[model samples]
Target: MNGEGKVVCVTGASGYIASWIVKLLLLRGYTVNATVRDPNDKKKTDHLLALEGAKERLKLFKANLLEEGSFEHAIDGCDAVFHTASPVTLTVVADPQAELIDPAVKGTINILKTCTKVSFVKRVIVTSSISTVMFPRSPLGPTDLVDETTFSDPSLCEEKKLWYVLSKTLAEDAAWRFANANEIDLIVMNPGLVIGPILQPTLNFSVDVIVNFINGKNFFNRRYHRFVDVRDVALAHIKALETPSANGRYIIEGPIVTTNDVEKVLREFFPDLCNDDKREDIDMITKTYKLSVEKVKSLGIEFTPTETSLRDTVLSLKEKCLI
Candidate 1:
């Protein structure tokens, strides 16, 4: 077995993407230590316990991102650690420092601190967002291509009040600084606006982007939807860990679609769910910069098509009664 006898710890294992990572880890025959805010919250964890190998191989630990030494129990005996816990609000937050920044930056530092104390740990993979790379200081031209090399401007993020982006940018920055100073092998997975079927009952921010359109909310104007399936993102994390030469950051993204493109696909497959009146506000000709995925593709990921992802998303939403 690929993961036989190997133990891994995934922080925020009950989240939108981390849940899938836990599921994938279990299926690979790995012993998994999953950390969440409240391990006994059945509403947040029932789906995780029901996974294929959960009963035998999965253990849930309670952890607080802001509290020091909270992650020690979960990460102590693990071979690798996946740090995926971070606030992901896309809307205006009442307290950016407490609600967004502290948890993200402090949580990362705490995890790395714990990782340093443990000798058995070999690698740490952090889940970051393309926002840290794509949100440049200046406006990007339509022909511009974004890759792993670009870092988002912290000052610019603060200027625009992009709290979520700023949080991710700063957190990833903290992770790299800690990893480098401690000589810990670190790999970062930067995924773009993740969307796919939901395993957790509650709707996440990324999934809400699709739900907004179904509910007749015209949230898009000059925006582009850079999407990657949740499953693919999970798989990418494992691939990064398993691959010997996998180093630095990988931008895990797929087809870049615009508001017009989104409306066209939704209308074609989900005509009843889409409101035609709301789509009139969409700007078809506004182009967005493309993301470079060649680095991630080197790991042999053939990304799921955009239409397939959208169809599966709607089907899952309907099944969950969330649409």
Candidate 2:
């Protein structure tokens, strides 16, 4: 909000979280240079085009994660850069490292290299995940609490073959190292499972956790994790960019949630989709995880309540006719 009319570039502008970041920037009157893999792909870009300030303020560029120097054109002359592009998946694939780690780690290096080329760029805000801080659905003590200071041990992720977590952990580490070595201004926002309303017509990764549960597609193990509203994470990105004192990593986790909470919320809004008889199978909040949010709170953010987020997430899906 401090620098109106300033130019900003957001990579993966069509992604689950990046779309919200672009929306917030456009609404605030910033000239947004948004990068997608294909500028011609209507399916990937139509949601962004529908945003309030998209017509006059939004500019789309074709960029790729693996291609070198692809982001240089879009980032040139921008005041700030948001590196939000990364691979995400829950299903186990044939090659984990190649699909998840390679793009995330290499893509981060490429973006930072672009920053060095674009000398006028003031700061880089990276959208890192809480996986960089803690492992989800992994064993933890009852009193254990994860915060920004905690860095996940990649060995465990490797042993368990948790590709998504390993990818995020490696990517966040790579970004911080490159920024420090090159003396580039960098701030990282580590958010937990991002869930909320949809901007893109396609289903976002976080939204799937809820949709699958309501539809009873969850045949595998039920993951217990914390969640944050996507909109709040977007605000944290801008706040970190504008606030001078904001530095290093900030935990943007919301409420600690369980499968039981998911069932309860769905039953209240859509009884047709809910099967109350299966509630006995869901483990109550006997085991929960907590993250310290005092640092992000200090940045003057008022997080939306989890109940409100869950309600909006379902409503958004219904409006989109995706349910």
Candidate 3:
């Protein structure tokens, strides 16, 4: 497919990862038709508008996750569509299903329906979470290798109250079903907890985990988290778009860092701000889980170092006064 002057659409254009994908696409000379819930909201669209080459190549459209046919206009004339819109909140809301399920599963199907109508679309990349593959109820040991074939049992997710995990698993399942039924090319990316610098003013859910750690909250539940820089995830999307042989699902985890590893980085970055008194007593033997990177690595994607990713993320938080 031609990259020059190609039109591409991205849902949730204002989101953390989606914003980076848009930045990369615009830099690569692709005309981006980006969708947000409200195009009139200056806070969401401002960063996107200021992106390089956005003046001539970017177009913003208002689209709702629950609204059918809302994303039709945005993705209609595109060669590829990146569906990155999903609820990232981890807290147990009053209406967990509505807050997580409907928007993720139903919204994915809505985009696929629109893409089916748009004849120009050659590829559809859906942003699924690593939660879809990892068994949150029983995390794997350090040596365990999680790949595309592994899936979080949906029943297990429901029984274990893993709403966010359930949302992604269901959404990706529905997308694959729709793609198969319509004979469309679909590639799903299950990225582990995404980290890195902020292109937006507010903090995302993934970054908020780090913030919460600094706040000395939820330490009793401390465990290892696999992080993939958002920029690398965006590049993987581009790689999948370009690789004709790429199919099925791909795990996008970069490095696995334990909670103690995280605290060490925090202390190193901000000694004064991080209160030792408030810090949680990290376990001597932290349980760690790992994701297999063989699939995405086959496409030649290199990830940012764990230490560098953490340092830059904290520095960026400090720069934005979020720390």
Write down the lDDT of every candidate, Cα atoms only: 0.88, 0.85, 0.85
- Our tally of clashes for model 2 stands at 0
Which runs of model 2 end up more than 4 angstroms from their true locations? Answer: 136-139, 217-220, 223-225, 275-289
TM-score, structure 1 vs. true: 0.95
Best by TM-score: 1
Please identify model 1 stretches exceeding 4 Å from their true place.
274-286
Clashes of each: 0, 0, 0
Q: Taking the tens digit of each residue's C-alpha lDDT, what string does model 2 give over 181-230?
A: 99999998898878899899888778987787778654334435466899
Clashing residue pairs in candidate 1, if any?
A: none
State the lDDT at 44 in candidate 3.
96
lDDT pick, better of 1 and 3: 1
Query: In candidate 1, what are the lDDT values of residues 139-176, reduced to their tens digit?
Result: 77678888888999999999989899999999999999
Poorest 10 consecutive residues by lDDT, candidate 3: 277-286
RMSD (Å) of each candidate, 1 decimal: 2.1, 2.6, 2.7
